[model samples]
Target: MHISHTSEDDNLKRLLSFSAIAIKSSCGEFDIYGEKDTDVRGKELVFERTRYVYNDALEYFEDNFLSQITSLGISLIPESDEDATI
Candidate 1:
């Protein structure tokens, strides 16, 4: 079936995308990291410390995971400035 989303629906959809990123990252499907240091760094990838966060992690999701979906010519319109903040 075909369905269309209004502006309100679009905003909600984008906001809800955070949960998807969280779940996939937590499950080791989408890695929120780039490089890793060991021994001198205790050999681990930690969040916001040994690893990255916020924009870095968000960028990882967009480039690795989200890009694949959105690249299929899907109409994933950005809701608004408010949606961009999240």
Candidate 2:
């Protein structure tokens, strides 16, 4: 049996929400929707460090991925920011 489209949509939505939360949390943003805001008080410094690490890692991966593809001689058409949102 195959997964249903509804389930796929729900999973995608949840993943996107999780990514948003991770980005915010890494940047020391208050989690108004959860108890982490109070529970992690005084830990924003650590989260601030995490933000740099995450950005560095993301940049590394993007650069590595692009280099791998370009080295294979496959030309990539650049997409506009809106088209690349997902």
Candidate 3:
């Protein structure tokens, strides 16, 4: 799945963007932005990290979001064969 977030706060935006990309990659899926010209099947999940503004958004996502999604039986596709060169 693809995940992303944006905020007026630069730090939060950066953190969320980084965390989203990391989470998606770790789950074996490429970041959405990286697949601009390709067709893929997956849901784009957005989180309101601003709610946990003071805490580490990355940690919260790992502890809360990742596990929850995994439990739901969603499978992350490994890097495509074409990406093997990279």
Candidate 4:
């Protein structure tokens, strides 16, 4: 089935873009801690790895989840103030 892009799709893309920006800004860096190796005495050696959280998140959204969502041709149009009941 061929799905045509509409104004709703554009709106959804804008929303997604804005959300990604927010996520990137808030999650700038993260501390990743894990066990790196063990000594001869069986003592575990721990390490702290600093990574850019936003880059990882952006990669995931663009390379993985976003592709899937686009393939499914799903779009969302948020309700405006005029449509709000309360």
Candidate 5:
């Protein structure tokens, strides 16, 4: 899964305050959490099932989520520190 900023503003203040989408996949549940960007830093998951479910859920999210955000005129800014695994 990928997460990125979607605005022209790049300052840490602005970027940190922006809202971000968080996805959580469990054995029998797929959930999304939207919160301020700063809240996501260093967050980690320790469940084995989460990794498996995430892999499946992300395939669906990539196919469906990108178009939805693009249609809304949101431009995704890639994370400079990491490469997309997918």
Candidate 6:
């Protein structure tokens, strides 16, 4: 018997799906911080943590989840710290 393999296999699809979910979750957290962040220093800390979560998820997806697929691209994360605002 033989098997056929493709880039968008089941495991790879699951990985991409999970990454997308995690990134969305981080975005939600960023929004919540925007609402609840009152103090200047506290807000800065919140923003830094948000940045860490966003960038960490983005990098993890790039490093681990993206090597298998060729045509698919997720333009999920903001490209710059300034754009990361809001």
| Better by lDDT, candidate 6 or 1 | 6
lDDT of 5 by residue, 1-86 (tens): 34376453344323222212232211111212324332222122212223334455534443444444332222123344225543
Query: Model 1, poorest ten-residue lDDT window?
Result: 37-46
Q: Local distance difference test, per candidate?
A: 0.36, 0.40, 0.45, 0.30, 0.30, 0.39
The runs of at least 3 residues in candidate 2 whose Cα sits more than 4 Å from the true structure, single-residue gaps closed, are 1-7, 28-86
Error of 5 at 3 (Å): 24
What shift in Å separates residue 3 of candidate 3 from its native position after superposition? Answer: 21
What is the number of residue pairs that collide in model 4? 0
Model 6, position 53, has a per-residue lDDT of: 45
Q: Scored by Cα lDDT, where does model 6 land?
A: 0.39
Candidates 5 and 6 compared by TM-score, better number: 6
Q: What TM-score does model 1 achieve against the real structure?
A: 0.24
User: Which of 4 and 6 is ahead in TM-score?
Assistant: 6
Runs off by more than 4 Å, candidate 6? 1-8, 29-86
Per-candidate alpha-carbon RMSD to the true structure: 19.4, 17.3, 8.1, 20.7, 16.7, 15.4
Question: Which prediction has the highest TM-score against the true structure?
Answer: 3
State the lDDT at 38 in candidate 3. Answer: 23
Error of 4 at 9 (Å): 0.2
Q: Judged by lDDT against the true structure, how good is candidate 4?
A: 0.30
Which tens-of-lDDT digit does each residue in 29-82 have in candidate 6?
A: 233234433223233433333444444554443345332221121232336754
Those runs of model 1 whose alpha carbons end farther than 4 Å from true positions after fitting are 1-5, 30-86
Per-residue CA lDDT of candidate 1, range 38-81, in tens? 21121122222212233345446434544433332122233474
Q: Model 4, poorest ten-residue lDDT window?
A: 41-50
